[model samples]
Target: MTADARDLARWSETLAGIARTGMAFTESLYERERYEEVLHVAGDIKAAARAAADEVEVEREVDHFVQEWMESIGEGVPGYVTPKVAIGAIVGNENSEILLVQRKDSGIWLYPTGWADIGYSPSEVAVKEVSEETGIECDVSRLLGVVDGQRMGFSRFGMYMLLFHCTATGGELNPHPLETGDVGWFSRDELPEATAGAAWWGSMAFAAIDGEQAPATFDPVRDAIWRTDDT
Candidate 1:
């Protein structure tokens, strides 16, 4: 979208207000229908702003504003907010065994990943998430790509995923009960059934194994990429 900075800021503020109100209702004893109505309005406002801006980045910024507002109110609300950031890794050894984890929530396999936190860069978030979820200390080698994952069901609000090719520098595999249920290494041909919403890995696997860098952003909702070749 080509909106001026001031206009984008205005729309972002409005969307944030809507999110705050919805969060407040969720915190209270509001009925499910009422809560859903509020969320729908928030989504509509976001859609309108995005339509005006005609830019994926603009829509993502607005979505982040809404998520920040919801997080500020607290986390009692169910499915009201999306993860701000996430780190996915391609961890392997000389034997080429890729690391995978089973999430406690869905019992599905996935790479070590988690949401971004305040004061952390995307790369930092990725490293921290990998360590926190799987206890494998990794150093990020390169940024493979950033892809929009809203359609993958991986995000509740809206999310941009940063996938990294990383090396396991040290540390043994230790699972965290609060985040992961199991951890292990597997070959590419022996990949496990990933939990729903972990679609980022499938794309990353194709990129890493083929030695290709998908250095463009994807809009999952539209099934289009912001091609580098495009002006």
Candidate 2:
């Protein structure tokens, strides 16, 4: 089918999902072969739509991604593939400062966040991520928001970010040596540099921190959410 950018992205993501599930669940060699072929076609879809300047390079990159994804495949019961859940904390201190961490790899400042462990509840995960990333003990108050990571362009795969509002209980400023570069509490007026989505999140975050009585924030419905050009 002829495709636009949104169509390409949708096709790529859908086929990738099928390919990954096939890798994890299918024991049949023929099925695996078919899925791998789908992976190649899905990868090339993006290049075909836009990155077509050098098709060969795009193919190489897509192959690399498929290989990496294959390497990271976690074994599961044959056919239960689904989106993963991540947890984040928007911790606020008594002073009304929000807890922030600079990621070691990206150098971007954001609320403390991590993948949710199997045994932990969402609130528990929130508190744990805050403590582990920023050395800040916290108590989760309530769910702040939930975002579709892929839809938000924060992830290539299907995932959800469960963000919780929290109150800092204790602990000193100490960043995780491996996962975090720096960590601290910052008031809205004194936020650090390179904070991801600060323009979209700044006011809402601060409002939550400042004890505002409002509904939890969520991504608004769009006529075409996958399309970048919204008018």
Candidate 3:
């Protein structure tokens, strides 16, 4: 997709997220009705953004997503909407192998990751995720990177991922019972099939794993943070 189209889609998703979050937290019927209208507008924007590529099924998919989003609303506390935070770990062993797991739901390979919990710090969550998902004990060494998950097409709602570099401390290899289908360690050149966004972070992750002075990565400042146009 063109950059402009991608920008439009992201905005649509952001607007939809705001509307849903509002619907969840607000008890006022009038406010909810307004939020519902925002949802409808978001759905239209999403469908139009997708339909730009001449896809016929775009409308159905967009409508279905909106309907599901509306149905999923529950009583939520009132606050400004924000992205959900997730933690991920890049665990590298002495053998220069990085740990990975295949998600049961998506069947795609990614580093150990999980939603942030209330009591855990970001690095604590990262360590916990690695152990829980891959049966690999790791010590959180340093933060590797932070990423906007929605912009990466990895989430339906807004999310930000905090990735950490970790050292394999101890543990036998075993996949999580319900979350993973398989888990393994791989070298830099031997990443598994169906890996998500490996091209972007693979080198940095490997560098950090290798004890190199790897700088953390984040999205660069865009000319118009919200717009895709060059000028």
Candidate 4:
């Protein structure tokens, strides 16, 4: 998708999040009305973005976005809007091959990843996700990268992907019966054509796998925080 469409969607989501957070805390009727207005405007922007991206009139109404955001509102800290967290593992075997899985829903190949569970530490989530998705018993070596899922086009909603490098201690290539369609160990040069986001993450993953002593990577602050292509 073009940067404009993505930027519009991002902006709309940001506005909706802010408004929802405000609504969660404010007690004044006037303030709630103001927040609702903001939500309405945000819905319009998101709908326009969808239409622009698809190059067709969207049947979904702007109220769809508003209603979804409204349903997510809570009364206290739970209502504080923030990006959702997901954990990803780049597990490498003794052969220096990377472990990847084909997502059942999208058929796109990526490292084993899942939503961060509430009770587990981030690294624990990484280990658990790998085992659950690919039947790989892995130990986290280090943090590999922290990436924005929306900015990377991996998701439409706000999310932070915590990527970890891991060593595949044991397990066969047993794909999860539900989550993954296939699983395999692939050399860096032979990554499947359908592998997702390899351009940005592939080199960093391989570097960590190769025993590089480097700091964990993250998205740098943009000069214009709201701009689409600032990098």
The estimated TM-scores of all candidates read 0.58, 0.81, 0.83, 0.96
Show model 1 residue runs off by greater than 4 Å. Answer: 1-83, 194-200, 206-217, 220-231
lDDT of 4 by residue, 98-171 (tens): 99999999899999999999999999999999999998899999998899988877677899999999999887
Residue pairs in clash, model 1: 1-53, 1-54, 1-55, 85-116
**Model 3 alpha-carbon miss at residue 213, Å:** 2.5
List all candidate RMSDs to the true structure: 11.2, 4.0, 2.9, 1.6
Best by TM-score: 4
TM-score of 1: 0.58
Task: Tell me the tens digit of each residue's lDDT in model 1 across 1-231.
Answer: 332322333333444545554655554555534644554455555555556655444444545544545466544454344445666777765566777889898898877776667798878887888788788898777777676544343443456677777777888899987878899887767777664443546656645644556664554343333222222
lDDT tens string, model 2, 54-123?
3345655777766765665555654455778999888998899999999999999999889989888889
State the local distance difference test value for candidate 4.
0.90
Clash count list over all predictions? 4, 0, 0, 0
Better of 2 and 4 by TM-score: 4
Lowest summed-lDDT stretch of 10 residues in model 3?
Answer: 72-81
Give the least accurate 10-residue stretch of model 2, judged by summed lDDT: 47-56
Off by over 4 Å in 3: 1-5, 20-32, 50-79
Order of candidate numbers by TM-score, starting with the best? 4, 3, 2, 1
lDDT of 3 by residue, 19-75 (tens): 888888888999989998898888887777777756645658777768976876766
Query: Which number leads on lDDT?
Result: 4
